[model samples]
Target: MENYIVIIAIISSIILFLSAVIVFVRFYRERTQFKILLGVALIVLLAGSIINVFEHTAILQSAEEFEQILSILFLPIIIFAIYESIIGEQLRTHIKSEQMFKGIFNQTFSFVGLLNSEGRILEANSTACDFIGYDNDEYKGVFFPETRWWKHSAEEMKNLEGAIKQAGQGKTVRYETTNIDKDGKIHYVDFSLKPIHDSRDRLIYLIAEGRDITEIKSTRLELEKHKKNLEDIVEKRTLELKTANEELQLKNETLYEKNTIINEQNAKLVSTLIDLKETQTQLLQAEKMASLGVLTAGVAHEINNPLNYIVGAYEALKQKDTHSGDEEAEMLLDAIKTGVDRVAGIVKSLNQFSRDTPAENEECNIHEIIDDSLVMLHSRLNNKIEIHKNYFKDSFVTFGNVGNFHQVFLNILSNAEQAINEKGKIWIKTTKNDNYLIITITDSGKGIEKDAINKITDPFYTTKDPGEGIGLGLSIVFGIIKEHGGRLEFESEVNKGTTVTVMLPQKGMKHE
Candidate 1:
């Protein structure tokens, strides 16, 4: 029996020590007052368990009493923390709802009041209380017509009573009436009374809403006075126009006869202009082609010289079969030659691609293309960014080189993915504005600084690492947009996000 008690005491101390360590670690991270109190209580319990393992009667009894004191002090706090952790969000939501209701009820400029169906004022907003110059408590449970907001006259009060009665019967009543403020000032107000029903459709309260319309009433009266003055001026203008019309009619006949001769002469000029325009168009086309050929040749000649250098280096290495060469050197020579040849091939291919007819356009939906772009980047979006798509249902179709459009979307989405560090959001909105289709791609990522934003689309300018990008993506997108007669723009804030907006015409540009 002594051995068993010792073993049980050891097990208890182990469990209490573990619990104390966990609580201390939690307090270290959180640094909350409740955690502080809870940590102290756990330490006391752990101390009591350790003392019990020794079997010292005097110390053990004192430790147990101290443990009881700590429990009494901290149990309520630990229980409160547990409750908060479980349902804190629900409590926060309820508090927010109360704040919103109070803001709308107390902070509005319009005079608003709630009344019992018998027309007794139950509550009034601050605006109503201030407007009538009465305390909120002063107006409680008072009849609406008898309140200070209404006039002192019997007839006015009777009319207000009638409106209130009508509102109590589920009918809305509205009228322009004279209301007396606290200082015996009369003001005209557009007042409305309506009945409010409970969830069960039982009439509960009458709502009184009002707007002061004294200035509007004054403006209407002024306009009524100006009506005759405007009519007199209009009559005078009509008499003058009548005399002018008679004289103008004779002059118009003379001018019309002269215009007939001019029209015949203009027809010959217009025909001559059309022929001249066609001739000019042909000459311009010829000039454009010649300039394009010269430019392409110059670019190819300049870039292809390095290609020959690499090829010559490889050939020299190959011919020196007797010379001993390191394997790394030989392998590098071969790689350089291969890379140069690919460059030469791409240059030649570009010249050919320009000469060949552009790929045929197809009717593609803008939203569908966006969807495809998102699919291609799903791996990146899986854990990092949430996609929000806002697109209309009806197909927004346009004649497009679908491959080119696909590249454009992919480039933009990839840039967004690279820009964000970790978790963020991307918002893509598509809408047709006037005759153009507008697509906006916005991301919550580290944004381009203002100085760098203008330089982003420039050739060979980049903010990416050496192996990550060569900086030609945005420039290519700019060219693609220009070919389609569209516009591209960017809005950004540092550490917030960037929004790329592209506007393309409904009808795509003609292929060059």
Candidate 2:
């Protein structure tokens, strides 16, 4: 029996020592108060186990009372450690996760809300609350179908209730609906309700999402009206042509000449219709560009004020005596300064690009403009595409609107970047030929086809996928070059590469 107790005591001491080592390592890594408490409790248990082993092995015969005291003290310390490390840590993590979710939920652009299994609104994002002029507090715990968004129309309310019911049955429901906003204006919404389930597939809650499609709906309606008008005009023209054909049949002696005249008229009408369509596309592109310019200008202006503040703060921080001789702090401050400078440069480029009014003709350095445009598009290149600049020795300076030249190079460089799929190289070169300065940009990308090369500069002609581009980039580039008394040229081969040449008259030469 004495030998058996000795063996058991040795095994318990071994287990307790291993546990204590693990707890101490965890404390060393995390260095938290809870971990410290846990490590101390583990050490106490390990000490008592060691004392028991010594007493059983006849090494310390009078330590039994001390072992009993240690055993008594171990219980409360372990309880406190368990409570702090497990329960307290889990509670903190839960609160942090909730805060992160709330931030994303409120910051999203779409209308979003959470509904309980019983179809009552539990939480609504800021966008949804503001759209209907109701606070989140006002909408909480209210039946989703009876909320302010659907309260104006009985049919809508009924439809929403049906959607909620379907969602509760584990079905996703999506449809377009109309709702009245806070200002009494009607909005078209693409709405959906999706059921959320627990790990065991039990229904827990529902997610409601809505996106305003009022502009798209209005544009579609306008297009339908125009299509109807065009149909009416075609019908009228057909009837007129039929009447003329009938008259020509009756006057057979003069049939040939009348038929020729009607054919000519028909040809002219078709040509006019084609021109009208081209003009409409151009106008639409112009409107989109105008809106983009306005947005860019506003954003640049907003960012500039904050950027100045950051620069001022960084300067002040660098001069502080507390951070002197600290290499890590100095490196961090340098990084902040570099980041601020980069943002300022981007804002300057945006301001220049957004300028619509033509400035007086100035001496623009060809290389500088190209460099600025590259900075603007650095994000797209992402270091995947290599840029090789082979500028002319003597800086090719020309007289033109600096902003227009910036736009020209920006559009060209952007096209070159988009042409490459994964990895490629872009080479920009400049040289002078007689009274003209020539700039060429070459890209090692999937080149344009022979058929598309000619039409690439035409308005609304694009080879890119839908929604990726509007195909007006080259058209705008062409217009800018022509305005500055320059000509644009393109050379390409399938799967090989493309070279774009831009030739502008040198300074002191007549632009006309």
Candidate 3:
């Protein structure tokens, strides 16, 4: 039994040594008193075990004695651990509270200054330094009233002195004060000062804060001036209105006679406007008929050529000997059908161009309108003009009476054809620019002189020999483009060419 006791003591001593080593490691890592106490307890147990096993056995041989010894050592260690925990908690709380105070003080947008009880600045935050245009070193230990911020206005400085005195008495004071900056520029601030006291009820410092309110001050003054002006205007307008009422009552009979005259004049004016509108529309119709009249010879030629082709093809086929698997008949029929379709297209274009009533406004591609106009002028320009088309592939969409667009293109193109007495090239370019479609028609022709360019689109103004053109074509075009919220501009130099630019807005577009 004594030998067994020795072996148990040796095992117990090993556990105590390991526990002491772990406790000391924790003590070094945590720097806590609890770990130190745990380390000392483990070491004391390890020493008791070693002495029982190697030196003496009677004292630590019993479990009860070992437990009693551990209890005696652990009581004081527990108390120390509790005490150390409380102190650590207090230190952590103090650190967090200081961080919070510093965050609020430095990060606030308002100017904040910590002033000693004597109203001298002890510390100024970044905002305060920036606002005053001074470094921290410059303002430290400087009296609030002695700073450069109050240099411009004595009244503002007086107000500041009163606030400081109130704050020094442990009373909070708030007032507006004008502050000057490094450049002596005046600014208003919503200024406030409050007394801070220590736990012993002694004044520690004064916290001065100010938010910029210069714009607010200016606005208030403007509002007051406006109010005064409005009151004066109301009084003056009341007097004028009272006098005018009396005059109005006296002139009732004269006003009644004048109204009667005005009504009659208005009726005549409205009638004249209606007549003018009808005359204007009639002139447009007459111009379309005149265009058709010019195309009559071309239309006849267009129709006759196709008809003659069909006749010649038909006669040639009839005379040919019929044979099985002959390609001759099929080829002649295809030629005849093509010619027939060409004739049919010319007639259809003529019918569309000769509409008796104006077409309603519709969404249309300007390129399609240009194509139809070119189709109408086809016979006239077939071999004479080389047409260069640079049209927008996506198409420029605009809202307007499609017929009016047709008329506009027809008129411009007709002028172009006439301008070029011989063979030439005509370039038609369509492009987009910021809610507008720009169409540029450039014709290599005999351009008008600078003096005549101004009068080109004028009514009844013709550069053509008197009978050659009535000169209403471009005038009508100008009126149409203008009514569509668009403009027509011409750039020309004699014998070089003329470029007619048309700008049409794409928004809120409709026929007028």
The most accurate candidate by lDDT is: 2
Best candidate, TM-score:
2
Candidate 3 structure, TM-score to reference: 0.42
lDDT by residue (tens digit), candidate 2, 79-129: 988899889899989999999999999999999999999899999999988
Worst 10 residues of 3 by lDDT: 54-63
Q: Which stretches of candidate 3 lie over 4 Å from their true place?
A: 1-53, 57-83, 136-138, 198-201, 225-233, 253-512
lDDT of 3: 0.81
CA lDDT of every candidate: 0.76, 0.86, 0.81
Please report, as a residue range, the 10-residue window in candidate 1 with the lowest summed lDDT. 350-359
Candidate numbers sorted by TM-score from highest down: 2, 3, 1
Rate residue 69 of model 2 by lDDT: 94
Give candidate 1's error at residue 180 in angstroms. Answer: 2.5
- lDDT for 3 (candidate 1): 63
TM-score of each: 0.36, 0.45, 0.42
- Where model 1 places Cα greater than 4 Å from the true spot, the runs are 1-100, 153-156, 170-175, 194-197, 235-512
lDDT of 1 by residue, 331-364 (tens): 7777877777667665653343223234335665
Q: List the residue pairs that clash in candidate 3.
A: none
- In model 3, the Cα lDDT at residue 56 comes to 44
